[model samples]
Structure formats: structure tokens, C-alpha cells
Target: MFQPTGQKRLTNVSVIRYKRGRKRFEIACYPSTVLSYRAGHLKDLSEVLQVDEVFENVSKGKVAASGDLRECFGTTDRAKIIRQILERGELQVSERERQYGLRNSLQEIANIIAAKTVSRATQRPIPVGLVYKALQEAHFSVQPTRSVKAQALEAIRLLQQHSELDLERARMRLRVHVPAQHDAKRLQERLVQIETDAAKKAKRGEVGSAAQVAAGASVRGGSDTSASLQMVQVESEEWLTGGALLWTLQIDPGWFRTLEQIVAEETHGSGTVEVISLRVLHEGDHLNDVL
Candidate 1:
């Protein structure tokens, strides 16, 4: 066990990049106490703490874990965060949710329940029995908790009302094929108008930003058609004499459905949006590159 020498306060926390391209994050405290995790675990840790990146202690002050964990310079917080991340990662959406699809709220709730269950469990390799016990204790109903599969499905259905976590996921790049009936000039005008409205929505705090709203529109079909928009840039536009015009949009997943809907509406049901590729955006993915 890693022991603490003196007081418990965040001393140093930094992300270590290895020569072979491996990365690790280490959180330290006064004296020599430290907690470390692999790069893959960083996402969950950051999500639990609501931080984007583990900064070097010199630039910004060291961040203590929230609540009780802040006072202790031990592995408790690190282990708990890692365990939750692992459990949530292990969860897979039910075949039914995959086939019939889950409502957005359900998906969010499912994620929360998974995180909470893993965090609450006392034993390692958290057993299905313990999961049921936790859910029952917390009054989180997952019908037929006898089996893991049944429990997961039930949890997804019942947990749709839990607290939300703002975590960034992968972004999808789309090729919106517009009908030839909409000329290049007309398409440009519509795109501009769409983005203009996005800016207005951002100014009103209806969305993350003008960019998020504009980009969200291209991916999800623009939920708030007149207001919300994501910050996405048109990668390229290719035109053929009589064929459809292919316009590429790179956007985050949060507004993907909205983007698809808006495009269909804009094209008057004549246009179609197809995902060309998906990628997780990194800090290096600058606005200029995306735009």
C-alpha cells in the first residue's frame, strides 16, 4: 500500500508521456504519496473531476479530488474513479436498445447508473449479486436482477432520470448529399443562415457555443432549428453537373441527430446525410484544422 508521510493536500499532478507513445497520469501529495493510472483511465478520472486535462502543478494549481477525497492523499479516490470508469466501460447497450434504439434520456441515465453502481460496490471484480444489492438499496430498479443482462436492461430503463454528466465523446464526420435541385449558391445561403442562427442561440446560452450549435446541426439535424448550432466547418464541397452536391461536415456526437434532421428538412426531404467517418477530437484538433 502507498503510505502518506504528512498532511494530505494535492501537491503535484501531471500527465506523463512515455517515449513509446504511452501516457500515464500521476497524482501526488505532500511528501511522497502518489496515485497513478494508465492513459486509458484518464478519460474517466477527468470526467469524475470534470477536468479536461491533468495540468502540470506549476501552470495551474494542483486540483484536489472533490468532497472527502480531497483531504486524503491516498489511492481511494483514484481507485474509485478507475473502478467506476471500468464498470461503465464494460457495460454494453442492450440488443434491444441497439435494435429499437434508446431515447436520449435513457442513454444518459444508463451511463449514470453504471458509474454509480461501480463506485458503490465494495468488492473487487464487482459481482452481479452485489450490483443487484446496490440497486435495491438505492431503489434503482432493474427488473430481474438475477442475471447481469437483465439487470443492465432494467437499469437503463429506470435510470433515465438521474443526474447528467457532461463528457465529450467521439465526433462524426458526415457527407451531406444535397439534391441537384438546390444549387451551390442556394446551399451556401442556407448554410450561412443555419450558422447565423446558431450564433444567436449561443449568445442566448441555449447551446455550448456557436460552433457547437453549428456543428451539432450538421450531425444531428439541428434540434433547435432556429436557435442551437454547433461550431463545425464545411470541410469541402464538390459539385457535379447533374448529380448531387457532396458537402462534408465534421461535428461532435452530442448534436448528430439534430444535424441529420435539419439537413433533411433543409433539402425538403431530397437530401441525405451519411456518416463518412468518426474520430475523437483531441486538444490538438484546433478550430482552424476542423474549420
Candidate 2:
């Protein structure tokens, strides 16, 4: 529901590199715009009818000069500037369609650079030379400090070699853990119970015994001989068996919460729903057909 004014211009761009004990600030540009007027002639009398007899055209153009760098220094020096540039550049690239009107390829490059810089900053276990090489491969310039470069390379190597571990760590940071096998097994048992109990109550006129329910018999209330004598068949089909397991897992509290969040965010609303679990044992083939 938010809209941009479309009048904002790029400003305060800068770049830098560090080497030994010194820092080097490089040229950067922040683009601005201005309106320009150009002369043209009407080719026909009809053109005059659509506008003033003397027509003027206006064109938009960039007003900022090229190659200007803003300086940053001390403990917060070249590395810091590079980090800031990478972050801001990525943000601009992501919203480029609405910001600078850049292409997808350009945005991808920006993202890669940002990711590499952040990776290097956070984990510095690799050699500087390798980090520099990796950055060059990814089309990023390296800092002058040998220490920084070594750290960057170490981070890159770890990222490249143990991507799965890196991904697991990231997921852990987000507090997303996979459910254990035992938890899944318990959920499956609960599912079977709920299903068997509901089925017995449906088919019989009296409440069936616990053992009967576990054996997949429908409960019948009272001592009506005719109803009690009727046997309810439980299905043994593969599809039904598989579906029971699936249904059980689907209704798990963690699974349900995740699904609910996904649905709510997608629909942009808050709604409520009830989930139930069940369990049942094998009797005949009635469940297969009914399921």
C-alpha cells in the first residue's frame, strides 16, 4: 500500500581499499537529474494544430559529475566502506526496477558482491591471496591489507567446501530444526487412534470396547443383537495405509504452525482452523474403501 514519489536521486557514493597500514579512497559517482530543452521543427500544419505555433520540447538528463569519492577512515576504514557500499548497492540493485531501472543480470552481480563481502567479514579463516582470487572471480576488487585478504579467502573456501554445513548453521540461526524420527512415529500412532475411534462410533449403535476399537471394530451403543452382530470391515489397501501416515504428520503441532504462518502471510489475513489426530489398527478392508 506504500508508494514512492519517484523523485529521489542517488547521492553520497564512495569506494576505498586498504593496504599495509594505509588506505586509498577511489572515485565514485552519485547521479542527479536536470531538465534540458532542445529545438525541433514541425513537419506539417497538422502538428501545429495539436500544439502551440512555436513548440518547445523538454528532455531529462543526469546533472551529477562522474567519478567522485567520499572518504572514510581509521579503525572504520577501507573495509568498512567496502561493506557499506556492498550493502547499499545490493539494496539498490534489488529495487532497481523501481529505483534505477537496472537489469536482472546487474542486480545478480550486485548481490554476489554483497554476499562475498559479508562472508569475508564474518569468517576470516582462509588465506588473503585465495580470497583476493575468489573476489576477482566474482568481479569484486580486493582490499590492500594482507590480513583482510587472508581472512576473506579463508571464509570463501569454507563457504565453497562446506555449503551444506553453512546452510545448516544459517537455518539454526533462524531456529528451524527438523523433527526427530521418534516424534514422527508418535504422531503417526495418534493419527491411527483418532481414525479407529471415530469409525467405530460411526458404524455401531454402542460404544465398542478399547480392544475392539484398536482392532478396527465400529462401536455400537446398547445391546441391540442385530447391530452388535454386524461386523465392520477394515481396509488393508496400500493407499489408505500411506494416507494415514501422511495425515498424521500433517496435523502435527509444529507442522501445523508452519503451514498456518505460510497461509496467513500469503493471504495477508488472520484466520483460524482446527486440526485433529487419529490412530487405528488393522481389522478387515473397510478402512481402505472408506478412506
Candidate 3:
């Protein structure tokens, strides 16, 4: 059995362990300090380490053997070895810490929901506190694998199901004439950022959602108008050089009044607005806010 080194005990400690081949090395660090260093918030390396000694077994307070360190690391420089381990080690956190981190990420989902959506009645953004309350009432949990926006969208679904809030994404669809180059360019910029194929071409799916993969994909340039290409597709040979375009776009409703002003100003009051249907979206309302 290895003799314990009888070092001073620590509270809220986590072990960062690195393994190579069949050998292992470890360091005991204060949980909060280690993350700060890793996140580049702490510059002094010594501040993060508890004992400043590499260990063979942290639980038993057993320091690593010098011979083993030399054989594995090719040098016995303690600082170099410790730096390597910290740079490429597995941080071991307790279950309570794990759950706490998850709660923070889930709360991020609530924040996203509040930012991208509004109360249907007031047409005003829902406050973050109330959104957080709705999340708890719906029993939402952290899904580490999914994007924050996707999870927030799912939480909104649950809120609607429970009738907790009559909230709509702050978005609207419009059928309007777009000016070539200027307005059309602005409109195309907001087009569904599509997924690419092996050939690097935009893979066409149902035209409703611009962001197909929720794996950190972006939501923009607009939405779900499976209205046939004949009806919904932007019409123009080349919209860049003053060719007129009849386009259907989905965008934040807040952008509507602004768009009307731009159109009328640019067209000298000749441009007009027409409404098709302002769809109070159901499941897949694309969003752009980041967490």
C-alpha cells in the first residue's frame, strides 16, 4: 500500500486526472479555481492547484513516483508535467456539481424562450422570470445534447400544452414586392441558411424551416411556407440590377414597421404592403438569439 503524504485536507476539491498507456497521474485542485484557469480567467497557474504536486493517487494523498514521471513524460520537470496534465486531463466533478451545471444550462433555455417570443395578447416580450417559472411548472430538464434554442422551442411547446402562456414567436410572414439589389439582397440574406451536402451544395428540403439541423445551426432569412414554389418562391431573373421581385418572407414582426418605412422611402410611396396570413406558429418557429 502507498503511504499517505499527510497533506492538508481541502474542501470543494476536484481531481484532474490524465492517463497514458497503462499509467495514470492526477492533481487535486479547488473546483472553482480550476475552471477559472481553464476558462482563461485565472492567469497564475499556482493559484488553481491545491498542493502543487502531481499524485499517483489523490484520494490516498500518494505523490507520483519520480521514476514513473520521467519514464512517461521524458523529463521530471514538475511544472511541465503538471501543465501537460491540466491541459489534457479529465476533470472529475461530484454529482452535485454536475447537476448544478445542468441547471444553469437549462435556465439558459428559459432565457432564450423569453427573448425570442412574446405574449400573444400583449404582443410584448415575456419577462425572463415568468418564463423561468413556466419552465419549472412544465418540469423542463436539461438536454445537454441539444442546442439551447431547440430545447427552448420544446419548452415553449410544453408551455402551450399546459396553457401556461399564450406566447408566439415575435415573427410574421409577408408577401411583398422587393426592390432589386437592395431589398432583394436584404431578403436573400435572410433566406433559410440551408444544410450542405457532400458536394457542398445547399440540400433542399421542405422550405419551411431554414435551420434544419439544430446542432449549432443558425435560424434566419425565414420559414414554413410549403406553399408551392409557384406561389412562394421569389420571382426574378436577376434581382440584383433593378429587376422587380414578388417575394414571400418570414421575419420578426418587429421588423415589419421598419420594412414598410424602407419600402415606401425607397419607392417614393409607390411600394405597398399586402398580408397573406400571419401564422401564429406551432412547432418549428426558427430563432436567431444565442445563449
What local lDDT does model 2 show for residue 107?
Answer: 39
Per-residue lDDT of candidate 3, residues 173-244 (tens digit): 566776555554444433322222211232343323322211122233233332222112332223334576
Query: Can you write out model 2's per-residue Cα lDDT over 1-291, one digit (the tens) per residue?
Result: 443332122234321112222333221322211000001233222321221111011011121111222222234343344334323322211233333432222333333323332221222123334433444454433322223434443444444454322210100001111133343344334435544554567467453442232232232222332132222211111122222212111121112344345333433433222233221212243211101
| Alpha carbon lDDT of each predicted model | 0.43, 0.28, 0.63
Model 2 C-alpha lDDT versus the unseen true structure: 0.28
RMSD of 3: 10.5
Per residue, candidate 1 scores C-alpha lDDT tens digits across 1-291 of 553432233322322211111322223222111122223434434443323322223123343334323333234465654343333222223455433333333334444434333221121123344434444444653332144445554453343224222122334567878876454446556656766776677667686642444333333333332232344546666776686677777665445666676677777777788877655233333422221
TM-score for candidate 2, please give it: 0.16
Question: Model 3 TM-score?
Answer: 0.54
Off by over 4 Å in 1: 1-169, 181-184, 208-230, 280-291
The most accurate candidate by lDDT is: 3
Cα lDDT for residue 164, candidate 1:
29
Per-prediction TM-score to the true structure, in the order listed: 0.33, 0.16, 0.54
